[model samples]
Target: MLIHHHKTLCVCDFTTLLELSQPKISRHLAQLREHGIVSDSRKGRWVYYSLNNQLPDWCQRVINETYQASQTELAELLNKSLTSESCCE
Candidate 1:
């Protein structure tokens, strides 16, 4: 959901947006990275993650469909995130 909303995100962003622990967010991101569903790059002390642009067309389609199906809920979450104090900032 975060990826669908933001171009890129850090561990702090996930923790703040999802209200999850840093370790839990890191673990999930690591799995996505390992599966080639997401990619990461490090800058100084922070690691940023984004959806892999090279994902197969079918995979991208599935993601798009899923997002569309959950658009309302995801949008509400995004709005909440936007209103909250951003960890990235």
Candidate 2:
């Protein structure tokens, strides 16, 4: 789940929340763009993204609820695992 709230966010915001480098966040955002999960538009030098309204309700729900930082300590664990997996790929 992505932590993207209702606001249209910049890449820097994504990096800060994901605790990842700007380039890393950019790559993931690119992948998400490819899947049509997030749509981007450029305003000057910045790019903003938000969940597409065209998606199924379930997808929007996931993105909406994803912002509530996971509680189980499993979130940090899973984040580590995900980082490792992405780094290796």
Candidate 3:
């Protein structure tokens, strides 16, 4: 969802959207990064994540399909975004 809407998102965004603990989110993100599904960049004290541009076209299509199939999940994320904490300056 983050990749779909914002293209990139800080760790805080995922924690806020999923209502999960930071450590758990970080762990999952680490796994995703390790698998080359996502990539990260550090800015000041925050790390932002986005879909890896190096991923195959088929993989990108799969992501888009998954996102499209997750309408309810995306609605939940949208609701969370309205009141979610942000790491943006």
Candidate 4:
């Protein structure tokens, strides 16, 4: 749910999801990417990741529903994905 919310998302965003450290969030992303659950693309120094919508429809449904749940969480989710975390690391 968290991973896909920030489509074209990246590491710094995940950190805040679990209230985790950057390295920790990164590790999680690494794991997900390794499993083909997520994907990445380099934009200069930043790497953006998003759910591979090519996955089964069920998977996409779950992520989309989660993102649609609350406005605040959605805002935070996009912020983390587009920019780095707005606060301290």
lDDT of each: 0.85, 0.65, 0.83, 0.66
Runs of candidate 2 with Cα error greater than 4 angstroms are: 1-3, 65-89
- lDDT score, residue 6, model 2? 28
Query: What TM-scores do the predictions have?
Result: 0.87, 0.63, 0.88, 0.61
- All models, RMSD in angstroms: 1.9, 8.3, 1.9, 4.4
State how far residue 50 of model 4 sits from its true place (Å).
0.7
Model 2, 1-89: lDDT tens digits are: 44343256677655645677989888988998999888888877778787766889987776556555554543553454233223212
Q: In candidate 4, residue 46 scores what lDDT?
A: 73
Tens digits of per-residue lDDT, candidate 1, 1-89, equal 67966879899887766888999999999999999999999887789999999999999999889988998888777765643465555
Task: At residue 50, give the lDDT of candidate 3.
Answer: 93
In candidate 3, what are the lDDT values of residues 15-59, reduced to their tens digit? 777889999999998999999999999999889899899999999
TM-score of 4: 0.61
Any residue pairs clashing in model 1, and if so which?
A: none
Candidate 3: lDDT of 11?
77
Q: State which candidate, 2 or 3, has the greater TM-score.
A: 3
Using TM-score as the measure, name the better of candidate 2 and candidate 4.
2
After TM-score superposition, the amount by which residue 48's alpha carbon in candidate 2 deviates from its true location, in angstroms, is 0.6
